[model samples]
Target: MARAGGKWRNAWRKSQKSNLKLRHTQFDAALHNWLLVEDRKQQRRQKYRSLPHSIIHSFSAISPRDVIVFCARKKHDDVAAMLFLQHGEVATYHVGWSSAHGRQTNAHYALLKHAADHFVRCGVTRLDLGTVDTENAPGLARFKIGSGARVRPLGGTWLRIPGL
Candidate 1:
């Protein structure tokens, strides 16, 4: 059997070889046109929640360059990847939305490949792929897992009430 992290590393490496072009932009007011167009296109995506401009703006403001807006371009820009970075410590893979054509061409893999390199260059060692609904989103789980991230259950939510 292969080493544990080996497979994930391999997938990431494969993403690098793919010829998909990448553009990294700091999400800012200057991105008005991009934000509008991307939001509009992302809304029509099936089985995905539509992202709003306000939320995008808020995230961008909160993290600045940490909120990396990655777009994978082919002949045209076909897919976008949303990554939230905690500077050098960790970078979270928030979301990745792609058109049908983008998916058909496996643009995400290429995007991630570039992301891994970028993170390393920026001194980041961790990439959190967030939650995966195994039952409802097996494909996503497989994708993340196949990319080399280990799966663990998130800590449960708890509340402490005073004078209860």
Candidate 2:
């Protein structure tokens, strides 16, 4: 009877594993479909507009030294914008995206590519893509990953002495 019970336990575990795998597959498919739909919508929007070149130029002019404006063209407008802060000679700090579009024509990728190319030309070795939260923002994480940026943990300060 003990041997029979052990066999039954193993069978149950196998079934559970299969079920988990199926669920994961279904979730992945759903997410992919959602991303596709979103991309299509964004493309349609982009067809009606042009990027605001003057705005970007103005931003660049007003920004302080060591800061550069990063902008991306969209279907109907210029969607994503950010600033890169030059720290000394080697590293560039990403200040975060200020204006982001909701579509998927890979505009963000183009912007990053342009920035990376410009940095390379200017003798900048490293481009910081900013900190990202992976657990709750998986889609954003995926987008960042698609930009060819590696993920790394960022350290933060802790309030150890009750604000002293």
On lDDT, the candidate that comes out on top is 1
Candidate 2 local lDDT, residue 83? 48
RMSD for all candidates, in order, please: 4.2, 18.0
Query: What is the C-alpha lDDT profile of model 2 across 1-164, one tens digit per residue?
Result: 13223433443344333211110011122323333343345445644222333433343456434556555444444454444655555434333332343133334444455566676877887777666657755655665555556668778867678767
Native-to-model Cα distance after best TM-score fit, residue 153 in candidate 1, in Å: 1.2
Model 1, C-alpha of 145: deviation from truth (Å): 0.7
Candidate number achieving the greatest TM-score relative to the actual structure? 1
Error of 1 at 82 (Å): 3.4
Go through the candidates in order and give each one's C-alpha lDDT.
0.66, 0.46
Query: After TM-score superposition, what is the CA distance of residue 63 in candidate 2 from its true location, in Å?
Result: 8.5
State the RMSD for candidate 1: 4.2
lDDT (10s digit) by residue, model 1, range 69-128: 677767665455554445558887755676665666666766776677788888898888
Could you tell me every candidate's TM-score relative to the true structure? 0.71, 0.48
